[model samples]
Every structure is written in C-alpha cells, then in structure tokens.
Target: MTRQELRHKLQQVRRNLPAEQQLAAAFQVADKLEQRLESFVPQETTVAVYKSFAGELPTSPIIERLWQLGFKTVLPVLHPFAKGHLLFLSYTSKTPMTINKYGIEEPELNAQNVMPLSEVQVLLMPLVGFDHQGNRLGMGGGYYDRTLAQWHNGNRPNLSPIGLSYNEQQVESIPVESWDIPLPEIITPAKHWRF
Candidate 1:
C-alpha cells in the first residue's frame, strides 16, 4: 500500500484501540525498549529523549530508568520557525517545564544548551508509525526529519537513532521523502526491526 493508505489504516487501528488496551500496549512496548536499551550501557554522557504525548510511543519509564542509571537525559525544545531544529535541555524530575505550541511538555528555556548531536550517545525517537525498513511517520510536524538532516550534514559523531512505537503501528512500507531520516532500529511491543 501507499504511504497515505498505510497511514489511514494505522489511524483506523489506533482509533479502534480502547483506552485500557492502548495503555497496555504502551507499557508492553516500553518494556521491550527498556530491556534492549538496558543492554547497551550508554557511553556518551548525554542522551536525547522525547517526551510522550497523545498517540506517541511512551518513554517515561525508560527516562526514569536512565536517570537512575546515571545517564544524563536531555529533551527537545521546539523552535518556532524550524520544523526540526531542537534545543537539548537537561531533564530531571524537578526541572521546571512549560507546554510548547504543540502542547508537548518541555524543559524550561533557561536550561543551558550543552553539546550538540555529536555529543549525544543515543536518541530515543518517538513516532506515530513506522515500517519494517525503519522509516517513521511522525505527527506531520517534520521536526525530527529536519533535525536529523542537520545532524547528518554537520558530520556529527555516530549516534544511534531508534524509533519507538506500538506493534499495531507497524506497516509494510512508508513513503520516504528526500530529507527524511532513517532509523537504525525500530522497537515495538512485539519485536525489534533492524534496518
């Protein structure tokens, strides 16, 4: 099926999920991700993670676990004009937060901007849907695609990019744009798809 058709089918599946089942799926997916990530003891001091919202894959538990493991966790700060230029801010349970234009919670702007993407060891990317090849369909903001493109152009150090999603959101294929970023690993409740 085409990208739009696949997106439509995934939307139907999402709509059919009851609230309880949705939560269960999120928890299950998180468990799988946590297990895999746990094995790769992050060597880079700073890691980037996205905060979960709406139908996005959940990562709160993983974030908490990373914190306890002494890995410095950072989150994306959305830019007004840029589709995917994000400022990384240190994250803590008590860090002051504010909702951005997208209604996603983010760390306070005053937080210091540290090293760029090269300094980040791993990125736990969130997605609305993904395919076997690790092509991700986001919430249509294009922010992640843009940010990843910039990171690549800068020739930053190798940072593992992983997409998180529920099993129901997986598709056979997703249309790729010229600027779209491909993930190395795609993790879901049922299994992990590596590209």
Candidate 2:
C-alpha cells in the first residue's frame, strides 16, 4: 500500500479505538518500551521526551521511572512565536505547564533552555506509525524532522532516537522525505526492532 493509503488506514484504526482500549494499549506498549530502555546505559546524561497528547503513545510513566532512576528529563517546548522549531525544557513535577497551539501539554516558556539537542542522551519520540526500518510517520507538522535535521548538521549529539508505538501501527514501509529523520530503534507492545 502507498503511504497515503497506510496513513488513512491507521487513522481509521485510531478512530475505531475506544478511549478505554486506547489507554490499555498505550499502557502495554509503554511497559514494553520501558523494559527495553532499561538495558541501555545512556552516554548522555540528559534525555528528551514529549508530553503525551490525543491518540499518541503515552510516555508519562516511563518519564517518571527515568526520573526515579536519577536521569534528568527534559520535555520539548514548541516555540510560541515560531512554527516547527523546538526548545528543550528541563522538567520536574513542580515545573509549570500549559497547552500549546497544538493543544498538547508542554513545559512553561520560563523554563531555561539549558542545552541543544546535541546535549541530549536519548530522545523518546512519539509517532502515529512506524515500519521495521525505523521510519516514523508523525502527525505531519514535521517539527521533529526539522529539529533532528538541525542537530544532524551541527555538532551532532550522540543522541539515540527511539520511536514508541503500538504493534497495530506497524507497517511494511512508510513514505520518507528528504528531511525526514529515521529512528534507530522502535519499541512496540510486543517487541523492539533495531536498525
């Protein structure tokens, strides 16, 4: 099937999922991802993560676990004045948060931008779907693609990009653009596939 066709089918699957089932599936996927992530001893101290939103794979539990394990966690902050640009915000339980234009919860702008993507040890990326080759299909905003491209051009950080998704979202292939970033690893409810 074509990329558009697969995207449509994935959307239909998403729409068919009831709220309870979605949450249940997300929890299962999260469990599997956390287990795999536990084995890696990160070279970079700080990690980047996204705050979960509608129909996306949830990461809050995993973030909390990482925090408990003494890892510094940062959440992505979308520039309030710009489109497709991102800033990293150090996150803690007390850090203030607000909804962005996309309606996703994010850290407050007041949070200091400590370091760039190069400083990040790991990035737990959220995706709508993924294929075995680690190609991620995002929500079409391309914020992640742009940010990753920038990082790749600069003193590229030793960061590992990992995609989280449910097994149902896996496909044989996904459309890739010139600027699209490929994930090195993808973790689903059933297993982890590394490229």
Score every model by TM-score.
Answer: 0.84, 0.84
State the lDDT of candidate 1 residue by residue for 103-145, as single tens digits.
9999878736444676787778887678777888877777788
By lDDT, who's the top model here?
Answer: 2
lDDT of 2 by residue, 1-195 (tens): 766777778867766777777677666766675676675664337778888776666677677767766778888988766777888888889988888888999888873554567778777888888887888888788888877776566556577777877778888889887877778788776788898
How far off is residue 54 in model 2, in Å? 1.8
Q: What's the true lDDT of residue 74 in model 1?
A: 88
lDDT of each: 0.75, 0.76
The regions of model 1 sitting more than 4 angstroms off are 1-12, 39-44, 80-84, 111-115, 151-154
Which parts of model 2 have CA positions greater than 4 angstroms off?
Answer: 1-5, 39-44, 111-114, 151-154
Task: In model 2, state the lDDT of residue 37.
Answer: 61
Clashes (candidate 1): 2
